[model samples]
Every structure is written in C-alpha cells, then in structure tokens.
Target: MAQPTTSLLCTGLSFEWPDGRPVLDGFHLAVGPGRTGLIGLNGAGKSTLLRLLAGELTPTSGAVKAAGEIGYLPQGLTLDTGLRVDEALGVRAAREALHAIESGSTDQRHFDAVGDDWDVEERARALLDRLGLHRLGLDRTTGELSGGEAVLLRLATLLLRRPDVLLLDEPTNNLDRAARERLYETVAGWGGVMVIVSHDRELLQHVDQIAELRDGQVTWYGGNFTEYERTVAAQQETAERLLRNAESDVQRQKRDLAEARMRLDRSASYGRKRSVTRNDPHIVAGKLKRQGQETAGRLQGMHTERLEEAKRKLTAAEEAVRDDAEIRIDLPRTAVPAGRTVLSLDKVRLPHGITADLELRGPERIALVGRNGAGKSTLLRTIAGELAPLRGEVVVPVPLRHLPQRLDLLDDKLTVVGNVKLFAPGAGDNAVRARLARFLFRGGRADQPAGTLSGGERFRATLAALLLADPPPQLLLLDEPTNNLDLASVRQLTQALAAYQGALIVASHDVPFLRGLGVTRWLELDGELRAVDPM
Candidate 1:
C-alpha cells in the first residue's frame, strides 16, 4: 500500500547562541518526498538543523513547517535499562494507541476496530532472522548485546513505525557488512521521505540529493555523492581560473598606476606652471595641480577596485580550501616486519561452540566473514587478548593492535594527538603536534578532543600511532575498518595496506577492500576457528 506523503519547508531559519553568536541565518530548506543525504564537517549544525526540522527544538527566528508526522532516530539510541531488544524501542506508546482503538476508546463503536497487529512481532522476527539476528534472543535484555547489535535493534524498531517521514542520524555507524547491507536494503525499499546524516560515501550513493551544511548555511546538490564530488571539483576549477585572472588584472593595474604616477610627476617637474603660453603662470600651475589631483583620484580608484577584487578572489579560494577534504596522513615507518604467526586456533569452536584448529601467518590478508553475531568480532577479540579461548591457545609472536569494531581503546574525551601520545612516550610536544598534522590534525585540530574526531580521523590517528610505535608492531587486527569512512579514505587505507609489510588479520564485510588487499586466507567465524576455501 502507498504510504502517506509529508512535505517540509523552512524559511529564514536563523539561530544564535546565548552569547549572540549567530549559528544560522536566513537558512532555508524545501524538503519533499525522497531520500536526501545531510553532511558536513564536525559542528556544521547538521544535527541541530535536524532537530529543528523534527520539531524537537524551535528556531530562534524564522519558521519550520511540516505537513505530517515525522519519525526520527536520534544520533544515539540510549535504551531503557534492562529493556529487551523488541521492547527497548518503547513502542508501547503506539501499541497502546492501537489497543485503545481496539477497545473502542478511539470512537471505534462508530467505525471498524483496529485489526490484530499481533503479527507485528512475527514480522519483526522474520526481519531479524533474515539479518542473522537471533529471534529467541530478542527477549533477552538488550544490554547484553554488543554496540553493533544495539544499533541494529534500534533501527529495526524505527522501521516498525512506518512513519510518513524518517530521519536517521549515522544509521549505519556500528553495523557490520551484512547488517549494513540489510539496513540499506530496508531504506531503499522504504516508502517514505528520509533525511540522513552520514559520512559513508558508499551509502550516500543512493541518495536522491546531497545536502551539505557548511559555514552556517545549507547547500543542496542534485545526484549522488560521486556527482557531488564531481560538481565540487568543477567549482574549484572555476574558482581557480577566476582567481588567476583577477590576480593578473591586479598586477597590470599596479604597473599602470606606477607608470601613471611617474608620468604625472615628470610633467609637474618639467612645467611647474602650465606651458608658459604667455598666460598667468600661477593659473597654469593651478591647472597642473588640478590635473595631478585628477590623475591621483583615478589611480586611487583603480587601486581600490583592484584591492576589492583581490579580496573577493582570495575569499573564494580560502572558502574552497576550507570546504575541501584536506586529509594528509604521515604513517610512521615500521621498524619490525609484520611477523609470521598472525593467527592460531586449536580446536576453536564457533556458534554453539563447535570447532577446529587453524594457524596463520604473514603474506596472508585473511578475512573472517560471517553474519552478524556469528563470532567474527569475537574471534578477532580473542586474537587481540580481549577474549580468552575456551579450550584452545592463541599465541602472538609480535606486537599487535586490534581496531575494535567499537573502538573501545579510543578515549572519547582526549584529542587525537593526546591519544597518540598515550601510545608513544618521550615524543616531544612539538613532535606530537607534528605527528598529528601528518594525519590531517594540523592547527586547532591538534587541540580537539579525540572524542570529537570523525570515525575516519580516529582510525587514521590510530593507524599513525601504530606506525610510530618503537619497533612498530608486526601484526594488525582490524574489525570492519571501513565502516564509517568516506570512499576516498577507504581507497587510501586500502592502498596503504597493500603496501604494508606487516601481517594483517582483518574481519571486514567489505569484500572489495579484502579482494583489493590480496587477502588469500579465509576464516569464517561461525563459532570456532575453521579454515575455509582460500580466497
């Protein structure tokens, strides 16, 4: 059945801080049906604008008008304590309304009663099962699930609403590949308007239009993320051309003005008075003075105009650079080669704890692939020392770091520089700052708390620190490293890994990345360690 349509429009949407600093001014958006991607650098107010449209906050000035109900999933889903997966959504409110109609509390006596939606739970189970989630576990307290699981549960609940408008904030953040694909499929098949704030370039490829919030205003681009990138490059090229022409004009004007000044001075020196044409010499001198004044005025005007043009061009150039993605990574050289023993599983059992033993080594970019909660992260954690094998021994011969799918090792409050510093001691403060700059944390960014860095930046910082470690680690364990990165970063990291000499044990849902990295070994973490057909 076709769903209801909702329209939203905002005009002159201005907002300011308590100190009178303006955050938004005359911001306007015309939103109708279809999917739109919202993106911007940190603190561009994407989340704030989303709140304004969702009616969660009133604009300080201007208006936000929407036609119907809006369903929104906030940036973070904080479940009620001890809530079950199916029950944490707090859908009881909606269920109560349905119950009220069924009980004739909503004027049901004059109309048909609400049919039984008891099947709703069944439908939910089917969706969960399709995504490889445990249906029986739905009744279990959600607090027991991993961060990835919790996020998936919230998404599932949001979909059950079937609202006319859907708003999601970084919806795929914690999902593995299979879960991410499942969520993407659901969004693609959804029959409503959606506004998403995400940095996942691949996911944004499906958006109808790309809307970006920058410098206190929002700009929209027609087409997917790739199209947006192409458009941005074209704009940069045009700006560069304009800047060059303006610069040339300014230079020419300066030269002409200099010549004009010299010519006027020479005329004054030669004829202090107008050519002694047998006229009042003082009158002639006055004419010369007037002429000099005229010349000076014209020259000043030219200079002023040139100055203004130069300022405009410079502003455009600066804005373009600021808006551009300026990622520069300086990964440290590893002193130690990635050691040979990458992984070892002896009689390792997976899901329901069945199993076999396996040994791994360098020259292997092995991927542990499985459905969600199929022990992919678990096995990686076991290798990382976060989990102990129940009946087998997993040994490591060299330094290793685990990129937790949840990034638990990252300190949320500290800056990336601070975090990297924690990894390396005795590196001078200047050295630390310089190291951060290599990972695109130059200037004020070095002071930014680690908690604030984008997912991609966080991973980059971690990787950089790993490289900087004394006698750099020989083994790297990554769990879904590409989950939150843009396409450009993904490619850069992929290329880096291909050139890296260290052994890699990666558990990723990104098939392309694994294939590109020449990962030859396959370990499917179903419950125990088992060697699968080599990829």
Candidate 2:
C-alpha cells in the first residue's frame, strides 16, 4: 500500500501515570494525511495517546514527530466561562487591533499585532457558521452556551487554525443531531492528516481507515469502521478455527503417546517371554530389556513434546480472539405485564416550558430524539421524580430508575458494594456482591471505590446499583447513556438493556443504538412532545 505524503510518527513512545500505571510501552505509529479513526476499549490508551500527540502529556521515553502544526480537541474541554467567542477563537486581540487601525489610530503597534491576518475575525465566524454556531455572537461568553455549543465552539477554533494535523477526542459526545451532522460535514471536507478517537459509529464511518489501539499496540485496517469490523470478524473466525484445530492436534498427540506407551509395554513383556523360552544369557536378556525401555522413552518424549507445542499454539491463538463479556441477568421483578400502564405524563410542562403528555404501556421501548436543549433530559428527569414539572403531573405506576447522562448517581467515596447496598439496603453483603458480579463487578472489583474507576467502570457500577435497587425498577429512563463510552462498553450496555423487561425511554442522538433496542415509539421533542415514525 502507498503511504500518504504527510506523516505523523511516534517511535518507541512510553508513558506512565503518576500512580505508576503504565498505559503505553514502546508504542509506535505512523499516521499520514487522511482521516483515521482510532478505537479501542475504554482503558486501551486511546485518550492518552491523543494527549501525547497533542503535547498535553509527555512520554516517558521516545518522541513524536509531525511534519507541520498539530491541533487537538480533547474529550473534555474546560474553557474559561468568561472568555468571549472571539477570545476562544484566539482572534480577539487581532480583531481589536485591526479595528483600532481602521478607525484612524496611527498606532504602528496595531499593525504589528494585526499582522497579515486582519481578517481573522471573519475567518473565525466562518468557521463557527460551518459548525452550526452562526447565531452565536463573537462577544458572547462561553458560560452562555450550552454544553454542545461549547464543544462546537472549540472545534470551530481548531478549524480556523487549519493545522496540518488535527486530533479530536469524543467530539460528538454532547452534540445533538444537527451539530453532529455539521461535524460530519466538516470531517468530510478535511484534507490534512486527521485522527479522531471516538466510538460514535456514524462519525467513524467518515474515516479513511481505522487504527485499533489494544494491548499498547496499534493495528491498522484499511477503509472505514464498517470495513474494519468486517475484517476483524473474519480474522476472529480464522483464529477460532485455528484454535480448534490446535486443540484437536493436542488431543491426538496425547492419545498417540498413550497408545505408544501401551504397545511398548506389551512388546517388552513378549520380548522377556521369548528370551526366557530361548534360554538366552541373563546379561543378554537384561541388555535387550534396557534397550527396549530406552527406545519407548524416546518415542514417548517426542509425542509429549509435540503435545506441549500444540498446547502453546492453542494458547497463542486464543490470545488473538477478544472475549468481551456480556451482561446477562434475569430481572424477573423488573418485568411489567403487557396490559399494565407503566407511566403517564398528563400535560407535563417541563421547567423550560416544553409540555409533554404521554403514556407508556407494558415493556415499551421509546427513543427520544431532539436538538440540544430541547428538554428531553428535563422531561426524563420529571418522569423519574428527580425534577418537578412546571405544570401537570407525571404518573409512574411502578418503581422507576433514571441513569442520567453524567452518571453521577453514585457516591464517589463509597465502594461499589457500598453504593449497591445503599440502594438495596435489605440485601446482605454476599447477595449484593453476587448481584453486582452479574454486572461485571466481580469479587474485588465490587470493593473498588467509585472515584478510582474509569469512565466505563463507573458507568457499570452506577448501573448495577440502580438495577439492583429494592423492588427492581420496572421503568428505566436513560439519558445519552452511551456518551463517552468505548465500543465495548456500549455493547455491554446494550446487552444489559436487552435483558431489561420493562418500560424504557432513552434520550440519545445515537440512532443506531436506539434502533438496536427495537424502540416501539419515537418521540421528537423540540418545544413539545410529538410522536414520530421510528425511522
């Protein structure tokens, strides 16, 4: 394959956290011009690699080499709340200096400050418009923007710079459909070397290739994420086949070794009888016995060694296959009868004035889709009894639970078991742990502090706590549950939800995920609740 001209290379890169947690060791990568999607499990060092590339973190060893300037948009961006849009774009001073010179100020300093980029403000606005932030004014403070808007603003800032290499981490986490579409368009138009670390399937489909970071190494796959998936599936199938073949070979070798030993034993007995019948000398008979035993031992050793080699090959083949455990549990208490009315919203007006009136029956799975700040979250919160409706009432006929987007339902200082116990106070410690294990927090993992867990682990812990609560919630409401989760984590979540036999309302822009849930109803919330086709 021909490599692209522009390249970003890392050689023998190594990094360790302050706590002595080694993330990458002797890592190497060479990314060239084109859009590349970087994916892996939550703790696979995708984010850390990006930070290293962007110079946010220094590698313990080795170096990063880039042909030109690099720009990075981190997963979580914290901008000064007081920073103006133009300031966030890094053009505030240049715009002011240009204006000062144009207004007849004879200050040569203004020209020096403005330089040749006198149209910086125009370019910044154009970038913002391209990112769906056209209505936002340059002087508007960051605090005035929504979470999605702030992310887009930062992206716009990056775009305005036109860096030779661009890196984005979970750029679509907080974006709504419209904002996500704009981002997709921007990605499509990018011509330079771009590396995006995201689990958003739609966004990943726009990439030229995929780089999977697993076990501290990078594996390149040509084409987009879909192609990567197909290739990986085929590879896994082949690995599995080889593993089965190796297992069969080992068994055959073991059987052959045993049969050879048995035959050798019978042959030695026959030889002893023949020597005795022929009245051979005692020394000659003893020599013949020793030689026969030695020959049998040599052949047996060879068979045994072959068996060991086959076992080793099987182990290696097994390592090539990924075993991402799925969450499978029987939540009998969570099941609702088909005719039961699980929840009802009667003229429920959200705090933001968006009225929602609806009724959920049985185990209905509903997908809530809308633009950012459309009150989808607020409505879900009201249904969960976490927020008070401005007008009307919410009727939840059964026990319910809400998993918010931030996943802040657990106490950070408490252990996973302690958190689960808080919800299932009546359950014994052993029972709580046994139930937690079903959610993938087995044994010592249940004793881990919530604060020490990674994003995916914390989410799972929170989920376990909620699902194991007393009475077993019959109505589950989740708000953007897949946000910031890796692909494996997303799969785990989907598997867990698949076993949930209850009414579910998930407010997420992840259409692919919702579709996987077989959502029975689709509701779009702009300013009010309106039912739409599932498509």
Q: List clash counts for every candidate, in order.
A: 10, 0
- The best candidate by lDDT is 2
Task: Name the TM-score of candidate 2.
Answer: 0.91
Would you give me the overall lDDT of model 2? Answer: 0.87
What is each predicted model's overall lDDT from 0 to 1? 0.70, 0.87
Tell me the tens digit of each residue's lDDT in model 2 across 297-389: 898898899889988998998898889776666788888999999999998887656888898899999999998777787788888888888
Which clashing pairs does model 2 show? Answer: none
Q: Which stretches of candidate 2 lie over 4 Å from their true place?
A: 1-6, 65-67, 78-82, 410-422, 425-429, 443-452
Deviation of model 2 at 136, angstroms:
1.5
Cα lDDT tens digits for candidate 1, 62-96 = 99887766777765456665886657744444444
